[model samples]
Target chain A: MELLLVRHALALPPEGEGEEADHLRPLAPRGVRRFRKVVRGLRGLGVKLDLIVTSPKRRALETAEILADLLEGESWVSSHLAAPPSEALLAELPKEGRLAVVGHEPYLSELLVWLLLGDFLGQSALGSLEDRFPLKKGGVAWLEGEPRPGGMVLRAFFPPKVFRI
Target chain B: MRDARAWVEHLRAHLPVALSGKDPEGVHQVRVAGRRLRVYLDLLGWRVLRDDLRRLVQGAGRVRDLEVVLAGPWALPQGFRRFLEGELHLAREALSPLLASPWTAALLGALEVLPPLEEGQALRALGRLEAKAKRRWKALSLNPSPEALHAYRRALRRVRYAKEFLGLPSRREKILQEALGNLQDLEVLLGLLEAFLSQGADREVLALKEALLVEREKNMAEALERLGLA
Candidate 1:
């Protein structure tokens, strides 16, 4: 089974205005444009997904839903792919068919590490000084190989900046 | 033949004996008793028994899978665990809503029909099961073929499924659940068995068999106790 892990596009800053409103923050305009470009790139690479799964979080779900419409498959909202998706969730993914998951950072990066190397490396392994991994909004990682955890071989890592240029 | 009282009494009396018996005939008998009781429960509108039977069936289903794991030639890779769990999650999600449907109610309702214990019918079935179980035991004791193991597992599953359909008593669920746990351990043994078969008889295989035998005895004891045979 092949898996394509896509990070959701950039969102409005959490610091703006009220707490509840921050949770509802939509993607930034540039983030939207960047996501479209990334989607195009995915299409360019001929990634045909059998299923599109996204975090329940709004931004991630929206991004996945859009992609699901583009791809010939059903889209599901799963907390399993959400930020800090549990080991149980990781254990639950199907082994057959091509799948795509769109969600936020930290979790996405952790998932990547967990898939590539059977262990979750937290934030330190992302090669960034900040407390978080910078999988810029709309970044995409193309992984290939068996669906088993730690069985994935990284094929490509496409950052939003790369798509921007 | 359709008498509910007679059906229940016969099932109650025969089930324990069949379960405790050493041969496949006994196992088959126990299974028959379970099925008869389930049919009777449905006929008599025994809701509680029906529910109990459902739980028993679920537990038995797990045991059945375990049996395949134990007796089958192939062992699911560790990665497959994650895949299975994921599939289970998806299945549960899909099945949740269907649980409330009338079809489910009707299926459960079908468990209450109590067929007549007419002349040795139950006994014949039980006898067949007991004989099968004995044959399996002998095969395992002597040759330990994969096919024998698979048959043994299937017999255990039949027992479990029957219990679930009957919805016997509260303790039945706990006992069945424990038996299911034993089945899982047996599945691990099966995996080892595959390893042994594929790798050929060696010191490691013998060592694994010894360890597995110990575990199997413990699990079997637990299962027998749970089934109220002990």
Candidate 2:
């Protein structure tokens, strides 16, 4: 199984003075354009997603929706992805085939590094990972193999800037 | 900052050069590139793509090791030279399937689909990598244990790869990794010698064992000094 961890594309800043403002903010116009190319790149790589899961945040939901439309599939929104990614999300992941996850940063980066370091569950066994492989807006990391700690390996990675479109 | 695509392209362009080189240096390049490629693929969970490359590396690695011993003070012992040369031929034969696999074309096509990285994203990745290296080195420096040294070598290799990828300054790391690598080879050779000697001792075998011990000590000392633990 391969996990395609994607960060949401660019989005407008929070307009209000409440936490909910951030939740409601949508993808910027340019983000939509750029992520369109990202979708092409995914298709170019012959990726056919078996499942698409996204955070509840507006930007992430939009990103997930875009990917779903491109793949002609449906997406599931989960609050589990809204905050920092945890091992709990592991259960949310599909048991077979390719899976794409669209979420926010710091969390996505943390999750990527932790998973690569063999501590996907953030268990104490692997101790703490001091480094992070940050994902920029619209970034994606590909990991093939099991989702268990140390079970996966990163195959390909791209941040938003990597898009030529 | 370099994007992952640029790095992948570099690897793709060099694969042919690395594969076709028959000299010691060329074979070594193939071995190194094969190892790096395998590691990168493994990290990304691309296990299927790695099998042929793994075989290529193992084959090249066996030849490289024998070449190293042949280049040493073995002084052209005709029997040993013939023995190693025959082994090198066998090792090279193991690589034919991989060479004929159209691997480069397939790999390049796969890599083209990778997402681009942000400006300075490479820098950030290297920064985090540097920090990880420092943390590991600090821990190993304090411990001075066998397991710690092994762990440190692993981190050093990571730092070395990141440095190579980003074109960062890595003279210290390069030297340290090289020395540590030699130390490992010597350790393995010594173990083999010990096992052979345990079976039965010849004057030539005993002399080679002594030479390997001296080389191992020298390599270990050099590695430790470079690591700042000596």
The per-model lDDT (C-alpha) reads: 0.54, 0.66
Highest TM-score scorer: 2
lDDT of 2 by residue, B1-230 (tens): 23345545555655565466455676677666656554443333322334445655676677677667667544543544565677666766665555445343433433443333343655566566677778878887887654567677767776677666556677877777776776666654555456555765557777777777777667666667777788
Residue B74 lDDT in candidate 2: 46
lDDT of 1 by residue, B1-230 (tens): 23544444543454344333223343334344545555444333322234434443353333334333434443344444344445434434443343343333323332222223443443344445446656655664554433454455555444444333334233543354444555555655555456445644555455555666676667655654543444
lDDT of 1 by residue, A1-165 (tens): 878888888776764576445444567777777788877777777878787766645566446644654566545445566547466565656788888878776778777766776645444554342234356678878788775557889888888777655
Q: Which ten residues in a row have the lowest lDDT in candidate 2 chain A?
A: A123-132
Candidate 2 structure quality by residue, lDDT tens digits, A1-165: 988999999998988877667776778999999998888887877888877776656678668756774443435545566666667777767767888888887777767766677644455533344334768888899998887656789999887666565
TM-score of each: 0.39, 0.48
Clashes of each: 29, 9
Off by over 4 Å in 2: A1-165, B3-21, B35-56, B73-80, B112-114, B119-124, B135-151, B178-185, B188-202
Query: DockQ scores for all the models shown?
Result: 0.01, 0.03
